[model samples]
Target: MSQSPIVLTGDRPTGPLHLGHYVGSLRQRVTLQEQYRQFVMIADAQALTDNMGDLSKVRRNVIEVALDYLAVGLDPAKSTLFIQSQLTELAELSFYLLNLVTVARLERNPTVKEEIRLRGMERDIPAGFLTYPVSQTADITAFKAALVPVGADQAPMIEQCNELVRRFNNCVGKEILVEAQALIPDHGRLVGADGGAKMSKSLGNALALSADSAAIAAFVRSMYTDPNHLRVSDPGQVEGNVVFTYLDVFDPDKAAVEELKDHYRRGGLGDTVLKRRLTEHLEALITPIRERRAQFAQDPAEVMNILRQGTERAREAAAATMSEVKAALGLSYWN
Candidate 1:
């Protein structure tokens, strides 16, 4: 496979990956692996920015997330899958970039704002949480990445990163850092089974990527459909239906799905039937992914080795960038 041209993307190791991740980004990462210089970081350090006290969870999830990456066909040979904490250069760079960014500016960032609200920390947001965007800027510019795949909600982050890049280059008298473009996925957000706006593990609305067929089917069976569509004979609503939502994503028979929607709207179509189809569709889709995950599960050490090797390569590139950044700032004491 050819290298990923120059893409920097990763997941926070807060928990195991779910179907939402697959639809939102992992599928694209699998496709882009051979096309870009992909750097997939298991962002444990970044997770600490919010979950500071949950070190055990962070520590355990690092390998679990790596397994998910390998299981999803993120070729360690093609994509650099690294543990973010291993690269000290990123921390060093983040500190310098923090000096260039202001607290008020970070507060104004949409992603941070939304996250602060979500965490219900209006009274007491952590300092590390506030500075995460700067650390993220460091993550991208440390490698001089040209592209960062982000969801629509995360566009502000890319803007913030670029803003820092511009300010840094202007202050330092050279454009040593590269401005990254956001590659937003076509399907931005995948709603949860409970009809929640976001599919999240904490909400118990997410189906694990590694979920078993029975587990997936159960989740689908319990999925939230249109609350108003109470009976099979009643005309169902598809415009805001979560069953149809999953169908739109997982169902391959687009014509069949469309037909089902029309039948449901015209009356006589049942939620059970629609849910059964969705369950079948998800089973078909997840079966192969589950099999792949099982295969990778046998070789846990191999997965760790892949992560270690990627970390080495990632550190080398980051170190090179840091050296240049230090020289740019006339801060390199080693000459």
Candidate 2:
């Protein structure tokens, strides 16, 4: 019988999961858990590549992110939720995969280059941060994942993974590693409240899943609308409006949102009126998440236990893949 298709995707535990994540990937993961075998990794190790000086922050955020996952309804029974650092085999596989890829190829990766530029790491990028793609290849192949949900911009990372898979298979004379396709969402990329192309915590533009009603209110009030639309009577440009972009994803009342967009385009719809509707729609989603997060936060030990069990199961899977990879490389003299 054919095995079920597996999906491997994760988040860096640098900060709380935000609305950008909710619209972009988290909501999809909750639905996907029922259809496929899923591995939700807490990418603490990957988080470290960029934040090496702040191990304490990473450790703290791991639990914080895991709570966010559980709060968002990722069932542990349906999905394997584990910490990436727990599986030492992934690092070992990464070492082997790195040899299969070249420095030039890594340097040429569009995603990595953009990240370096965005983070202003052009002058001083750590070696670990530079080779993150190879490590990601290891993460994907270790589970033989067939689907990896990524944004349009992350298509380059998926390409890099498939390249490493082909190279490894050809060199080892075995197709042990599987190539994955990117599951692109129909919705366009989410922009930050401040009108940035991306919603990021570093930029202070994201509203966290854990953000309270007051915080959400503050975010809604401060949200960027059409900069040129200084008056309610002015015809606003909806194309680049952050509030409408959010409504397109979060608000279920499509007809109402559409009418609001039309009214704004034609003039007379004020930003305050639009923001009030947005606040109501967003609160409907965030309130429940906050409640669940509060419940999970009460028992941190239970959360750790779930991760511990998941890590053990992940280790077994990673070990099996490593065994096959080592055999392919003729490094299994003892085994």
Candidate 3:
């Protein structure tokens, strides 16, 4: 029987996952695990590109991310959950791959450029931060993953990965490294609770998947709705309203959401009423996830064990690929 294609995707262990994660990629990962050979990584090393000062935070969030994954239905039996820092071969491969790409090209990567701008690091970009695409190429290529599920915004990173794949193959006069395709989800980006273009942990505008009832309620109450929607009788615009966006993504009843949108647009739907509805849906969606996360968190040892076993499996794959990479570069001299 032919093996299923490998799908590599992951999150940075900078913080617990939030509602934005659920809508954007976490929901898709649960579905992808059944159909593909999925490798979910907790990218601690990558998280350190900007979070180097907080080593403890990175270490703590590794288990936190793993717990979130388990709570969200990414089965250890079906999907391998590994830690990126554990796979030393990945860094080795990244080092070698870095040689194939020019610094100029790395600087030009749109994703990297945008990240630099967001972090306000234009004047002093870390070497690791600038070369993230190379590290990502190593992550994808080391596993021979042909499909990488990511946000639409990450298209440029995938393009750079394929470019490195072609360059490495051409240098070796053979196609040893396989090119990857980005699997962008149907759902667009999830806006922050404050209606920012992006929802981030550092921004303090995100609702964690493990949030309690009161926290969820508070977040919903704080959601950005139409500023012009001051009075119940006033018509409201739904163009950038965060509450409507959440309803569109989380509410299972599409017809009901549409009706709510119509009611909201035509006026007479109080912001409190809309917020209460959103709070109910969000609570329903998150309650089970929160419960499951609590159960997993109680046994942190088991979670670590799961990561260790998955890392072993990942290391084997990475090592095999590294051997081939070494041979391709004529660096396997002892052999």
Candidate 4:
């Protein structure tokens, strides 16, 4: 109940949000809205770092992502929801923060490196793509946000941000900026339907939250379970089972899920039956969200207005911080 902390968290406006997003941060954002000063960003600029080829995709999805935020119960009155590119101060701050970090340090970032390796952009990495850590630092520090909710993989990026915070403050001989720490949730990473290490839109391995019943059925059918459990009577492994993994996060009745797990391990439950349960649970859960999204989709203008209002408020905060940053460096111009 203590709104003592300022929290910053967001998603890239590249595609419709998926279950990985909900489990990773969206659900948490809904709760944090009541207890923290939260700012949820539609990271369009960051999305563009990789999607520069089709700028239209990034622009179009900004509203889609915003709709997802609202449908997931993010109260705009309690949380500022803004588009990342609309804040000019963040761009300016990123440029200044870039001076403090080294290229080698960025290259060593496990998150960014893994992304580059995954996208096979190693041979043709854009300068913007490589410098995103600095940009993230700007995002965190601009609002003086002290807490950032992220997945386990993104915690190191927070460390990178704090390092820059200390380096800049020390250089300027003042603590004008705040250091941030990651608030990683218990259910961290949700792997893909292919049993891949992570779920992502680019990899085409995610079940989007807004997926219709047919799409949901397809994803559940495609989900990778234990490969060896070919027969209904075969004892199955649960540790790496993707269907069970989704159930663990989605199913409301833990006792039932555990009992089903026992049944699968004891060699009677079939993948079809297990997948049917998942499909049923997912449909029940997603129907209302999909309905709400449909309503919002009817009035995209309303969504844009909400974003513009939040962006104006966010911009004011960023401008205040930029003034302090400039003053710290003795760079504040006249007046």
Best by lDDT: 3
What value does the lDDT take at residue 257 in candidate 3? 85
- Ten-residue stretch with the least lDDT total in model 1: 1-10
In Å, residue 316's CA in model 3 sits off its true spot by: 1.1
How do the residues 12-54 of candidate 3 rate in per-residue lDDT, one tens digit apiece?
Answer: 9988998889988898999999999999999999999988899
The digit string of per-residue lDDT tens for model 4 on 1-335 reads 43378899898888889988888888889899888899899999999987889999999888989999988888889999999998989999999999999999999999989989988888488999889999999999999898999877888899999999999999999999999989989886889999898799888899887899999999999998999998999999998899999999889999999999999999989999989999999999888888888888899889899999999988988899999998888887797
lDDT of each: 0.89, 0.91, 0.92, 0.91
Candidates 1 and 3: which is better by lDDT?
A: 3
Better of 1 and 2 by lDDT: 2
Q: Quote model 1's TM-score.
A: 0.95
RMSD of each: 1.8, 1.8, 1.6, 2.1
Q: Show where candidate 3 strays beyond 4 Å.
A: 333-335
lDDT of 1 by residue, 229-324 (tens): 887899988987899998888888899889999998998998988888888888887888888888888988987888899999999989999999
Candidate 2 at residue 207, lDDT?
Answer: 92
TM-score of each: 0.95, 0.94, 0.95, 0.93
Estimate, for each residue in 172-203, the C-alpha lDDT of model 2 and write its tens digit. Answer: 98899999999997776689998898889889
Off by over 4 Å in 4: 1-3, 119-124
How big is the positional error of residue 271 in model 4, measured in Å on the Cα after superposition? Answer: 2.6
TM-score head-to-head 3 vs 4, winner: 3
